[model samples]
Target: MKQQSLALHETMEVHEMLNLKTVSMTTSKMMEGVVFDQDLKALLEKDVQQSIGAINDLQRLLKKAPKIE
Candidate 1:
């Protein structure tokens, strides 16, 4: 099977998105404890979990890239 590779621009965009998701996860974690509304708190926790999953998936994609210098 032939292997496929991401163009450099696409890889950079993915990296940027990964950074954005990481920042969102960090903010959600910090705010979760401070939120007073029960529903909002639960929602924040869900966002945190989803963000984590997204970061993991993105990291996996980054790992699959050809190790170009």
Candidate 2:
């Protein structure tokens, strides 16, 4: 499949989003071990899963983005 190119600003934006998602997922996963409430733990797990999907999508877009020197 042909990869689509992203403009510099778009690439930066995606990179920022990827970083944010990574941090969010990491935080949720860590909190899962500490939270006592089952409901909140479940919510955290859901957020982690959604973040994984979003991070994967962002990584794919980044692969199409031009590499910075």
Candidate 3:
């Protein structure tokens, strides 16, 4: 079915985005110590927190998503 195919495609795309965001979260945490500026460090920390929440939400959604295979 076209609908199933579309759903699978969207699920894959979301997975890819989730992976990218997870990597970004790790980099942000690591870069917190690497940054010398206080403002940038704060921003990175905030991004890290936001990414964590987003990852959790995405994972929950993924659990409810239809299996592709």
Best by TM-score: 2
lDDT, residue 12, model 2: 94
Instruction: Give the per-residue lDDT digits (tens) of candidate 3, residues 36-65.
Output: 999999999999999999999888767656
Whole-model lDDT values for every prediction: 0.91, 0.95, 0.86
Measured by TM-score, how close is model 3 to the native structure? 0.80
Model 2 lDDT tens row, 28-68: 99999999999999999999999999999999899889877
TM-score of each: 0.89, 0.90, 0.80
User: What stretches of model 2 exceed 4 Å from their correct place?
Assistant: 1-3
TM-score of 1: 0.89
Q: Highest lDDT: give the candidate number.
A: 2
- lDDT by residue (38-66, candidate 1, tens digit) is 99999999999999999999998887666
Better of 1 and 2 by TM-score: 2
The lDDT of model 2 is 0.95
RMSD (CA, angstroms), candidate 1: 1.1
**Candidate ranking (TM-score, best to worst):** 2, 1, 3
